[model samples]
Target: MPGFVALTGPPAVGKTTLAAKLAAVHGAQVFRLREFAHDVRHRIDVDPALFATEDPLGWLPDRTVRVLLDSALGGRGRNGVTVLENLPGTIIQLRTISEIGRRLGLPVVVIELTASDAIVIGRSLVRRVCPACEPDLDADPHRPARAAAADSSTCATCGNPLRRRRCDGTARYELKLRRFRSRIPGIRREAATLDLPYQAVNATASPDDCLRRVVAALRSTQILPCLPADLPSALNGATP
Candidate 1:
């Protein structure tokens, strides 16, 4: 049977980080939407005559996800949990994505990361660079360097400041809410069908505490057959 776990929430809630930690513990494959977009962004260049647009989701992430889903289910040795990251935009779109998982017989679970608005706004103001091209800065993509020059808040290699990019206006926020609604139902549906619990995580807590909470949640739900020995260290505070 196919299986899926989505790490979702308003942007900058530490979904990406949590996803990584979960994947590490479960030995799962992580499919990050941003990474997928970044990898293929250059390949789909549009000409000026075609009335181009730079909407990251329009071409890259959406396409990449569809293709990835097809390939992952079609491929062999895909027994482990598959973590889908940064998936929340529109309600209809999210439902469509969840349906895809269901059609593939994937046991789906949704984990919504929650943090205070202050934390979200603060993190969103930080400028994070693309990790694949700027790994020297930091392995965590959300914490990119602020500058290329050596500074108090910058990476030594690239000097880029680590921060989250804030989206202007209520548009993005509204979109996020819609996505949440869409997945909330999917989570309930999955729980009813598979007899597995859905989870919500508070990422603002102490690293150890947060990991403990996640591990506890997973254990209480009986999602994991056995807790991994290294899970504690893996989820403890990531790179600064």
Candidate 2:
């Protein structure tokens, strides 16, 4: 099916983790908001300071996002769902992506993954992104990302040392979470105005359970072509 499944939520909600899993199941193209911004800004000479941890999205204009999305959709073949991580965040972004979705004959479904502050803060302590796997101001959106644990020393995929994201620090993460909360209502309203389906998923459960909820929600919307056979009936059951 030709459609998009956009993921949105505060810090440590596991947007990337869920997106990766969903992309694997659907064989979908994946777009991370920061990486996409980095790619476009690099091409057009956007000021490096605009990407500062405190206000990464503050200076990113909707026009930039719209043009990039249009160009991206124009270049790619529509075959399966495109899993977007932490995208369509602002009202303008919501409106712009919906326009692209309409003009390009693709459906847009927004999925907001939610987790409590306690859970998110706890996750922040453990979440680590591999630098060698993905460079900051990332130019390559398709590069593989290696997820690492809090105490891990090296990247599992690339064998390079893993590092914590600067923005993942306590104060910065809390700031980003506040920004996410402030902007989401407007984004949700925009989705409603555009007649797009928006779903909120609680992500405090185990990763498999959380993924199941997301997959079930997407399946209910019928954006996917069919049920994914890879999903087991139960993670653990009696051995026969």
Q: Which candidate should be chosen as best, given TM-score against the real structure?
A: 2
lDDT of 2 by residue, 1-240 (tens): 668887888877888778887777656677766566656667666566444444353545666667667767654426677877778768888887787788888788999998888998888777666776666622212233454465367777877776666667677778777888899998888888899989999999987788889877887785765423453532344321
- For each candidate, the alpha-carbon lDDT, in order, equals 0.53, 0.72
Q: In angstroms, how far off is 136's CA in candidate 1?
A: 14
- Candidate 1 lDDT over 24-98, as tens digits, reads 665766776555444544566623223233653232344444554454444421465666776534333355456
Off by over 4 Å in 1: 37-68, 72-77, 93-97, 126-151, 156-196, 231-240
Tell me each candidate's TM-score: 0.61, 0.80
- For model 2, the local distance difference test gives 0.72
Candidate 2 — which residues are off by over 4 angstroms?
Answer: 42-59, 137-151, 158-160, 226-228, 231-240
